[model samples]
Target: MPRRVTVLEVGLLVVLVGLAGCAGMGTSVESTATSTTDPATTAGATTADTPVSTPGSGYETRTVTLRDENGTRLATVDVWVADTFTKRYVGLSDTSALEPGRGMLFVFDGEDGRSFVMRNMDFPLDMVFVAADGTITTIHHAPVESDGDLTEYTGRAKYVLEVPMGYTNRTGVDVGDRLRVDGA
Candidate 1:
């Protein structure tokens, strides 16, 4: 005799499996978010004190320097590099808060028009889009979705940096500025 499975049982099993998969998705993102590094000391320098490797996450931390049009330093930020598809897709959505002077930098293969949304994000952000030549093309102060609707911020960029809300304004980082990533 063989055991038979009912339709309801099969549906329940499928639901459980889906939930299990989703549960594991935030493991890396959460680990990376919990870093206790002091952003003040980590800015503009890539040192041993500023960890580069995030445990359980493929993200690499790098110091990014923002410069004005005349090459004067505007601001410095420590950013987690999101170069791969999976890393970029997850982004900082799983994190609750982005520390001051800390951000996530998304790198693409080449300059192209791209779009980003605050999907499942717990905080607002300022999205800075940079061209391949390091010129900033756009800056958007994106707000967290109050409703279920997500707004897309589109720009032409090879790199997109997401920082705390009003960061661009606070740091005087504006369109046409330049972004220099350490060791990039």
Candidate 2:
């Protein structure tokens, strides 16, 4: 009886081995190890030489022409206009350098007493507030990351022009300078 039981057990083992034939655990382990070491397999990994979007991340910039007080064409800039929430919040943040000719134009829906501050900005800029009738109400010179006790230029201006520091002086842009937004 013991010899017969032994023969039955051996037969069962052979049947199980035949049914589960040749599946490799090593293949799965090797694939996982290879993916772990491969840089391209890493999620959200990019090369250091990856090209970032020009004119910034959230901005939709277009070529714009601006003139100075003497009607001199100062620059042809890719002017970015703010429309969405992210664009409005992150206006010019991390911009350590600015092109001499380019600037941003902020447009509001209606005339309201609005104030602006330079928060998270890396460069000095001039804020020109304009009213509905294209009248510049006030000019605010804000330093880099200036969120101090800066006074708000109180006016009901619907437009705001953010230009580089000393740009107003160079272009002779003064208070009451009429600003015309093309296709506004």
All candidates: TM-score: 0.70, 0.58
Worst lDDT 10-window in candidate 1 = 27-36
Question: What is the per-residue lDDT of model 1 for residues 1-184, given as tens digits with 9 covering 90 to 100?
Answer: 1123358755864675578568753211110121111244432223455333332366799988989999988877877888875567557666654444567888888887777787656567778889999999998877778537667788888888887666677667899999999898
Cα lDDT of model 2 by residue, 1-184, tens digit:
0012246645764564465455421110000000000111222122356432223555666444445455554433345675443354445554444433456666666766665666545556667777787767787666664556543434457766776655556555677566666665
Please report the candidate that would top TM-score against the real structure: 1
Which of the numbered candidates is closest to the native, going by highest lDDT? 1
Which sections of candidate 1 miss by over 4 Å? Answer: 1-56
Judged by lDDT against the true structure, how good is candidate 1?
Answer: 0.67
| lDDT over C-alpha atoms for residue 48 of model 2 | 53
List runs of model 2 lying over 4 Å from the truth: 1-55, 62-77, 146-154
